[model samples]
Target chain A: MRKWILLLAVFLAACTTKPSFTSENVYVGTDGVSLAFTKNSPPAEVFENSIFPVGIEIWNKGAYNVEEGYALVNLDQDYMEPGEFTGSTSIFPSDASKLDFQLMGKSEISQQGDRDTIGLTVLTKPIDILSEKHTSTVSVMACYRYQTFASPNVCIDTDPFGIRENKKSCTVSDIPLTGGQGAPVAVTKVEVKMLPSKSQDKVVSQFRIYVKNMGNGQVVDASKVADACSSEGLTKSDINSVSVSAQLSNGIVLDCIPKREGNGGLEGYLRLKGEDYVLCNYEEGVPMELGTFKTTLNIALDYGYMHSISKDVTIRKSAVI
Target chain B: MEQKRVFLGVLVIVSLLIIGCSGSKGNQPTAVEFRTGSSGLDVTFPSGTPQQIFENDIDVRIPIQVENKGAFPQFDELSEFTGFLWVGGYDPNILQASFEQGDIRKQLDPEELEGRSSFNQQGGVVLESLILSVGDLPLGTAVYEPTLIFYLTYLYKSIASVPVCIDPEPRSINVKDKVCSLTDFRKIYSVAPQGGPVGITNVEEIITSNQIIFKFDLQNFGTGQVIARDLVSSNPNEGFDWRDLNRVQIEDVRLGDRSVDKCKPDLGEEVELFQGIGHFQCTLSVASIASAQAYTTPLTVTLTYGYAQSQFRNIKILEAIEI
Candidate 1:
């Protein structure tokens, strides 16, 4: 009887704990969806004018379920033609419009994420065999929508000058980060500063958040996820584009300013190319009376990521005349 | 193999340390740090200057103290052109300097006035004395007060040496592992700003394929007004205008011998500072660098601008009772 009572009490305590993505260790890792060429699927060598199949296995290592039409697989058309496969498709489509629909993500109950496969069976076009053979690289690209969320306890010192005699909870200093927040685009650091405002009496809380692309794929604009793998609508500007938003646990929304965007409050392109910083400030200046305290900073980065792996195959002329 | 990698890592780190230690090349630092203090000359009245004096007493003297609080006047660079100290904004006949010179128009030290540094925080100070005879209270029976302005003008230079990452091919076709490519290695190193009224506040380095651009934030980090090197004179009271307040000139911008060109606001134009804050952009050709990895190098920017400082003192003269 006593054992049962103790177990119920322990479970109740856990139920009351706050739901924090980082503290609770939910969907936490530096990696998102990863794709690789299945072993021996795309044979090492093939005969000219013959058909071959390219198989890729994608694993969703993150916690967000990828909806149908959200994950697109593309085939490199320069080397081979989808002769017998799904012919004449979207910008650069696979045998199917999208990968496996309703691909579930990692959950507490199911520790390991879902897995799916894509097959691009194509007919090799005749090529001029120089000497022994002509080798070609068959590349498969997987572009999918992903998000990176990081929640770290940050110091918000309203009384940075120590005007009051009361003891403070936290002090303001730069928060440096290592590893990553389980996304291709990761927040590297956050610089905390208490600046004097125009009024002189109030202190403005400003944070410089640094971000970088930490994946084996290319970053595409979140709005153009479908066309990322094909390079149809993707331009130089569209590449390396990421949307960013941040807020405090206390419901105080921050005004985020990217280097490219002069105005604050808007997102996207928060960083330039691979690395940059975004300047955000508490829209409402922290009053001096509140003293110092600690709060969780929730930073969200959204973007379309595409990873490609190619297998080289040597095609020998069937009948060398 | 592990030992080989460790040896290579140590070699790279040692090489970077050597590069960081190599400042401008020809010039070796005399002090621990150069950037310190805001005022070119910290002027104050130590002892000789008194607040009140009896009419016809004739024993009024003020020793004006001037300290080279900033790294300028460079005594050696200025030669004899350091500038002059003038006493204006008061009646000349009522109060004279030293009772012999008739007016206070004196040349500076004729010797070296060293600026402030980490080793010598107080810097070099020079004292100029003024012997005055308080005249008979304007012949009127009461107390008279006059606000005296001690004007100081000198040519000063503010130089900022910043460490920047130079990628040979900023926009290379294929990206690989480089020293400064990682965010952990790329951090803002806040060395002291070269000391003066006008200072380079922050530097933003942007790396693109063909070009390496830098945006430098300019600020008047001092309490005095910055005068254009050409416009700074002994007495700007009679000939000064609004145009002289925020004017500065870029003397030299270089990375060792290679000149950083394609600068915004041009090179020779009088760079006007808006408010206390202003900025300029300059680009370095990455084509010159043929290395695969990014290396750290020093970017030295020299700016020549004149600074004007004034300290005011109010004095009262009371009529002596006729015995």
Candidate 2:
């Protein structure tokens, strides 16, 4: 009897020791990113027929990694791309210019922060200005990918004798999983629960997923763009709009819809646990006589995001004329 | 010896005569210096002003004028003041002197003064007359020349302005010298930017016997978008039109201890500013036209408007200069 107990303990330890993957890198949205035109870089007072340098600065204020980050600037005809000027490069089509940069995430622990800058030289075109003054507007847009992470623990138990102290003492299995690969909406947590029914003697598994808005913009219903939450404003249609799903080890997939209140985007649809989450369940017809098994939970969330900034530019008649 | 004594006396007389002539020449009347007041106003009784009058005779009139010879320009509401003229010294039982028209309060008109007087184009002189009536004098009076004194009291004012540049992005450019003058850069002047759209650029004063007029330039210095208070909507879904959202209510316009009763603002109720920078020739009439010497009185202008200012300053936009 003692030998059997020893063997059981060893087996349980082996099954419950599931290997988990370390996620060192995550991509959230650019919400933590900031961009600006450095002071006096573009020459506050620019003269006509001469190339002036405009410097753009970028800072990453978030914890996630951002990739393929770039800024595009739109200006009026009063400015032109440098043709033969030094450090002259054009990244956009007519009426626009682009600047690329790389940055590291801001870390409170290591006290490490990421910031970078790019400079562009553009020719100033002469124009007739009455009252000796002229003003122009420049629009700037940044594009990049960001990510969010959520992780929740689930209890898995499968003991027919009703002799197991807890799921941790029972022989259990773990499967490594990763998602939010192709879409902007990503799921970070996948928790599972396996329990036995007293009367039917059947096994039921429940899955819970944690989701977040990892991008620089707010998450909203993919079907609604104009009505989505953004710097422009927020509406009731923006709440609990994320759709999540889970796939069990048996290949069965379950979906959890956010519980919402009223028709407004502000209340209802239970994603509000301080963290947005959804729950799904799967039940088997009969109890398993059994052995320790491995299971994988796959999650997916559907959402939409938006970001923007504006600057005023003043131009002077070039002294070159 | 008598001849010699007479000759000596004649010599002494000649020397005395010469000294007397020199003394008389030095004592002649020198020019009288008349210092102008800070309000740029000078009130004085012109020549032919009556010094005496026969008691109990109506239609006795006295003429007085106030000279606005200040360096600054005067407007109806800007530098306007009031004046009151009363005839004293004559016994009230024997004489009744007051504004001939029963309008003791003098509302000095700068425009009218400018048109009537040749003193200065910007500021001119305001003139008025006071009539006196007589009560029953001492029975069977043969001759009477009562010394009647004309006492004047008025409110006076002055105004000064300097240039200021409004810039949202200060670091992007050196705007200290970039803009010229605030008054010249913006074509229209408004006193109200977010609150009233009514900008009081300059102030003037005019004093009369019973009331004082404060003439000021109420302008729209900013974008003249004015919204009336009653027309304001509470719907969150509907966006606000900035031009229609600018309205300013005159909470209180006071001078010293008295409040102005008659102030004509173009909008009828609140001051409305629109069409870039609109302007109103506003007038404030106060009954505090008491008798006081040329002095400065506290004038308070309080306004309430849906004051909101949100504008992006392009460092490239140069300011305007009056020069």
Candidate 3:
């Protein structure tokens, strides 16, 4: 009976413990995808006029499901040709047309973290007897849609109302902040200041948001891709075009758009400079009743990312009897 | 049996004869031809040349050629000529030799040479006539050969220049292309400039009213000695003495501004890089400039001295007596 009672108490104590949260918003989807050649079977050598297998491993480490993912192979047509795989097609060196997609998986959801492997078969072209050995480089690329996030908490209070200390009913002190997260773009810093308006019923606040390009991808307009990222026909935009929105705890929404300065358009461009700090202005129509509130700010960033990894293979022309 | 014995005895005699010839050849001495040293100077009397003279030959002139086969050029005049050639030997006992007072210091033109003297090309040569004064020996003195050695001394000067970057302020704008600036002249000029026979090892700068003074130390980078100019000619009273020799002139002080006028070598017009190393100080007035921005300028120094180079020729001295 005592052992049973002790077990019940331990279970209750365990249920009462709160789960810890990440200090920053995590875009688990984008940061989790990793694609590479498997260690057991890498692209090293292939005999001329013969077929060989190349293996690739793709890992999905995000919280959400990958709707579509694929790998494309680029090779020199004069020296080699892709075998009759479903996605493999003949491409010239100068052919800039996007590679035809091979579906790696459909609705592949990674709960904790899961890795998938695929095999690609390739054949080398015939060579002359005088040419004993020839080297060719094959490039492999992975393309997919991903998401990331950044969250920063700021203080919003109306403290100078001359309320008696003895009758103090509200106070806002040091609250732990959630830092910045995501790929390609990250909110490096955020500062907020509230100033009293001359009118008796309103107040104005200024928000300075710092954004940085953390990856090699080109940031572009999200609307053009229809909420999904595409590697084709990628045109870049400036910082002024970045979309930002904020909301108070009382369900009041505020939009902060950047004004054009110099060569930077309405959304200042980073190609001209390297990074940017955007100033956002927000005005409250009604004065707060001497209290503290929690607010949320949303930052939307869109970009086109491309990664090219290559390997060298030698094709030998066997000696004829 | 007797015929075999005879054949064996003949074979033994032939073998002994062959061994005797081989032993004699092995004992013979090998003739080795020595490399006549310029070992400082390679001067020697030509083989088969007559050394003994008759009483009638009072001041007979001998031809001595000095081919500058060394790495450095011998000059006659630093301002105009390259080096001087003086031919005299060690022993003064048996013979007294004299050259023409004015002709004693002769100039060898290095300009006429086909190629300039560098690490690759051999230096030029100059041939001059040497007069030998033979004294009266007792009637039966032993006839022997006395070496006619020659000594050539001249002042050798080496010049080098370093680009000193000077700005009004004390900081280097480009860390990669370090220059001498006002902030730290010692740090930049702590080492010497390359591609010259001489190096300006150390330099110091002092800025005064309308004038900046640069103090420097010069070092010889060659294996040879640097001759002091003042010691070259014995008689300073004579007009041709090398009193003003070994003069180092700083020429073409450029400060980017074409309007920079009166940039003078304030210490003096000419200073000597004495004993391979010399201390030099000069000043330039920067007060006239309208702007005090930092800039780079070149400093060029030219050294002039009567350089000396030497070579040795082997000759055989023969005895010639008149009855």
Candidate 4:
């Protein structure tokens, strides 16, 4: 009896022990839709005949079912539709067309499994897209129903697209279209005149330089010019002593008054007595290019001032009348 | 009367038997036999015997292994044992020499010796002798192995004659004086900023106000103690100033800053300064001073320090600052 009781107790203890069960489930689904484009031909040179043949593939990586979908290859607009399409075509628009683009066909990729892949090809003739060089996007969109056991089916839509481009228009051109000439300067004209002053034995010849629109661009203030005689070099005192005179080309001797009532170059008048003006003597002898007697007439203009044209005139002793 | 005589005779016989048994007990071998050599407990020297000098101690390892060869299980609980080293035939006079005179003659007293140095019982019995002074032993003298005897107690009975060999022979050393003297001054001139001008002075002040430091390297040139008094500077006029004649000094100086007095050299224990090279700096403070008067005198510093009864000199002169 005791043997039987022991066996029973052992059996009871074994039966009272609880058993545990464990299980694991793996699930994989698509997250969203994606679109990619492959070029069929090499890019065209800047001013050449080139056609861009592109193929686009849209992938839907989700556990949902897509009901209706469309892909539009429109310029400056969105492409969304549902159907089957083999390919599409577009002509690169001109300026008269105002940078417009068109879509031809549509294709549909039925949601068969958790992931569905759709492919579309776009063969576009070489268009002069460089006329309005800017960015354009080709988009693909689809609407699908998302279903799960824990929740009712939910409908979601998405549009994914890739860009087709003209390589020449996409990159900055190295050749500058304008303004390659050196720094521009503004000036109406420059005229030099010699007028006689008082004395006869020593003709007081006055050299005048007419500066028009003096303080215009780039060529502004004048640098100091050295005289043939002065050994110490030109000082501020020498620069200040020189006088500038302004006159009209029509011989209307206007008042030699400064425009701003200052000693500036803008419509300024300056005078030098014949004795005060020393003619420079060249030891190597003056070249024919330089007149026999040379005197520097320095006029200070505002910063960045330039003269488009300049002329020089000289007056000397007359043989006889 | 005859019966009484027979009884007495029997008693005499019993008494003789008892006496005989007591006599046999005395004759039984009191000497206990223990396994020796590698077969039993063994002593291993990590450094394979050491040749040490006077007052030098080395670690001696004695590995003990106990075997119960008896039929009945025997629990030998050796709580404590007495081990003794018998260094026989050593000249007592040599063991009595003074250490100061370079004599190895000195007796290492048991009371003054550390117990651990000579006795170990917890894990395999091992004992190392304390620092011994083998007084004035001739060179190439052989130090014999001392016999080690361990008194073991088992089952409350004391047993002697557990013999152990001193695996390797003890160290024998000849005493001699160690003399050290400064041989050369390796002047690792501080880089441009730190190095002083070798010939020219005054053109430009060294950016860093580092002194001309001289590394006085002393070599054990002679046989002596290299006594503290031996370190004497030969150039007394030079700035070879040492705070303590016994210890070397490191001098550090910065431009415009006062020279820091003798910096102590870091010497670790067990590392005897047999060849000591001290760095002494001679600062060019005069050149660093802004005023012309400061450099007018032109400072020339020479250092002299005593080293092994000889004088070492390090001379440095500060020239004028050019600008």
Candidate 5:
């Protein structure tokens, strides 16, 4: 019974013990195993806010009989956490998806003696975090053909890589206030031409009126009556009582005739007494010319008391000149 | 008997070994667990007539009551707690005290609370002073509806922690009976330039020089009265310069009732001009000859006054224009 027990213990110990597999006196053929990251399959660049997917493939070259061993890849310690392989599957799984990887294809390679070159491809689905920076590593492992030996874990020393960048939106603040309606006013164009009346020694000029809506709204029942006038060239004492007729270019007769005044200047008020008289000043008048007696008409609107409109007009000399 | 003794000895040794090994692996306090309790406290300000407080009146008595519904015991000594009072996001530059132990309780010295004001004469009332204390508190004692925060120094084993905090709940306070007086007379407030020429010709530079001046229509607005004096001017990139410009007495210059002697009167009653209109004319100097870039300067005018010398107070108004 004692002998049987000792034998059982010896068997258990032998089963647990692993044979020594050292790299000594082992002749390596010219076809040495070489590992590389696959082409057209580089790791993805991750933005600060988004995620990236990566895959990696490895190539092994060895002439002599080699064991079917697995590869272990180690990401740079500073940038990424250590990554491990999934069970028998070729893909690698990462605990943190928010990481940037350097290489995409197979991060690990297995040693199969039947083929001159062995390859592996690993896919790492990682998310790129905008809040922080990250990096990853790649490595390979091979197993010997004999059960008694295995190859050392091989890893390529490469710089860590980051995911693609995500752009930040530009923003601004504190915009100023603007936009409001200004004052209300109006403008009128007057043309004066000196004509030889039937009984006058000097030529008398007839004043033609052209009223334009220059305020913010339309004008209705506008009465263009002269309040005062200059006696510099006229001979009438009731110049203040002198009434003259006027009309708009739209063929509408003005409500009241132009009244004369003794102020030696043509002074009048156009009573634009209506609510819908909405019209902008700049679009109200057409450019006209009368031969050389330059003058401007100033019209005041009731709404904006301080604002007024002015238009340039010309008077022609009689044929006597 | 010898064989029995040997067997007993072996058994004893085996039992001792097993006991020693198990003892080595006994329960240990390896990982520490930290527990925290959260609570809040509400503070109130007494309502009454507006108090008139001057710079000379430094120490002001503010009544504050602290109620704790948390599991922690109320601090026996008020000295263990720290408090702060904020008015309109500013320190009112006055010391706060309460009645405690048959004496006026002052947490901070008067020097620490001096020389702090809202700068802008905009008034603010003190809602409450947040008080915080750290000590062994019961589980629910420190946790209340309104959290109470104060400066506290506590020790857990060899580690000591001090936390400063404020109550996050919203509160309101009455305007205390106090008045602030100004020693210097500063800028007079007025509206910005308006009704000026729309189109300026011969544009050597877009001169804001041709300005249309209008008096502060006393009849329409009011008798422009001033109390405190604070003249503030700001540039584009630079900040505002708040300084005491000059001191002048208030002379009533209204057209109808109060007009200065030798001043002309027009339109019904005599219009009074408060101060020099020329003084308020801000010139917009052209900085660049080619670029149309212009800078806007804003002037903030603050007045300090009262019904009498004994009841002085201050107020502020702002005016800005593109220069």
Candidate 6:
């Protein structure tokens, strides 16, 4: 009896699938490159006329490598100065307090993301004669270009008049998705509809893809990311825009309409203000005899994300002064 | 020993008495199984609505209590909602309602609000605040009394499943022990009304050589009036008018899977209920190729109509400080 029990256990174990991490699974997470102030980077209190260090850590928690990224620190210039970290001799983020590049995202070999740090020594300028203490908010910005890859199963029904319901593998319905799909932006839902063709040939598939910025960052237009960090200042339109394009598994790209031109043909990308969706139609109506089938809808969202974190530092007057 | 035996006999008698008493009166008081009722919804304006309000009183609230008092319940999956309610009959400028023109058309219950039954005797009561502070009442020279009419409109369905005998040849005298006689079909079959305010009360059958004719009598068991589908205004701006009452739409009359297409209402498809009853007749064509064997099919009569009930209130807006 004991031997039979052992054999039964072995058979059950063999039937169960051993869980393993695939290359696709490594890229799935809700995190993106984030900026954090190290513990006491700007000490709780700093004496007047004394020099202190402000530090920021840039962590790439996403799967995609950031080709062009930068971290800019903002401070009240009246009460502080870069001191020796400025002028022609300055090496800190090229004297402008902007740290660029040198960060790699998550990979198959290293499941965890790579991280880098930046520290800058600065002087606290003298305060007014009467004020005993002064406090200022120190903020840092991390901006990077990222991409989201989503492959959700889609239903395609070619036959119109034929009753293919009982035998069909897939039904046309909205597919709701949760959790992030390998990037800062996530495809939340895909509404599937098999509409009758206008030419009276057969039924065509139309999908509405809804995307949201899951990461705590303001989305930017992919084409304008380089310009945003460059000499040209970032405009209002440059923010809250995501470039989106989608295709089917059969290599037939979907034609998404209601496009707003300009921005590297991200296929008339949607302007993201919290959440948005795009409508794509399979224009070449499938031949009537194909019946009902299931295929994957591959969607790619290419955009720039910018996140910010702020800290407080109290400036106390020196005893002798 | 004799006294102990007497005591045992008394105990047995007492046990028998208790069992007999409980068994005889156990089912006397139970929740009433309400199959027939006169009203689907018992609507009444509760207290707090002022019959007279001064011009200074900016807020005048009127509350209307809507109770599902019939056997047909309002379910989310079966029907979108019980019906819509609107209050009109007063000048919009003088007495302005807090609700918008679109907001006036309100659904009775979005979720499941069951009607009268043995399980839920009182049914579901939805308190709808009708006039939430009728404001901007002009200070007239004399006492101004405006009659405000509050109308409730909702689509309701009434179904009747009647067991009917299909006779291939009713004139065949040689047939012995026939399944059901054409003259005695009324006594053989019964009409079961499937719980709606409007129901089929009686049915009379007529047999011909090639057709079976059925005459049905439909009545409004509800206290409220039935309205024509076309007469009710769907436009939010138009609201409810007085001309939209007393007509019921004959949706379908079917026997098993096949629809009896020859069914016709006495007046028309949308016929007005005289007093509270209406008549509908349909001719079911019997195929000449049917077998001599007699079979029975449940003839179903479905009616879709808008039920409406109204309550009017006369209010006088007096001057803030009497002259």
Choose the strongest candidate by TM-score. 6
lDDT of 2 by residue, B56-172 (tens): 457777776665543323343444433334333322333455664664334455454332112443356667776766544331122223333333332222222212222222233
lDDT of 3 at A304: 30
Better of 2 and 3 by lDDT: 3
For residues B1-323, what per-residue lDDT tens digits would candidate 3 score against the true structure? 99999999999999999999999999986653221112121233444344545432466766665554332332432243344455432123334555656344544445532122332244444445666654543221212133333444444333344556555434335444334345533324554433233445666666544555666676655433333454344211111223443454443333443322433343225556566566666566665555456555655544433332333332222223432
Q: Scored by CA lDDT, what does every candidate get?
A: 0.66, 0.44, 0.46, 0.24, 0.23, 0.67
DockQ of every candidate: 0.00, 0.00, 0.00, 0.00, 0.00, 0.00
TM-score of every model versus the real structure: 0.43, 0.30, 0.36, 0.14, 0.13, 0.45
- Going through the candidates in order, state the TM-score of chain A alone for each one: 0.78, 0.49, 0.63, 0.22, 0.21, 0.82
Give the local distance difference test score of model 1: 0.66
> For residues A1-321, could you state the per-residue lDDT of candidate 2 as single tens digits?
999999999999999999994322232332455767878766556655567676767776654455545556556665544432124344434323654445666432322347777676667666675424466555556654443322222223444344421111122333223443322444545555566765444566666665555444445554443333213434676543665545443235554544444443211134433456677766542233222223234344444333445565566664433
Give per-residue CA lDDT, model 4, range A59-154, as digits (tens).
Answer: 443222333223333322211121223343222222111111111111113222233333333232233333423223433222111111101011
**Best candidate per lDDT, number?**
6
TM-score of chain B of each: 0.80, 0.33, 0.49, 0.18, 0.17, 0.71
| Candidate 4's TM-score | 0.14
Model 5, C-alpha of B17: deviation from truth (Å): 72
Give stretches of model 3 more than 4 Å off.
A1-32, A40-42, A60-71, A84-116, A127-129, A159-182, A216-253, A259-274, B1-323
Estimate the lDDT of model 5.
Answer: 0.23
Candidate 1 CAPRI level: incorrect
Task: Give the chain B TM-score achieved by candidate 3.
Answer: 0.49
- Tell me the spans in candidate 6 whose CA falls farther than 4 Å from its real position: A1-24, A83-94, A160-166, A198-202, A226-232, A262-266, B1-323
Model 6: DockQ score: 0.00
Each candidate's interface RMSD (Å, one decimal) is 32.4, 52.3, 55.6, 54.8, 38.5, 30.5
Comparison by TM-score, 2 against 3, better one? 3
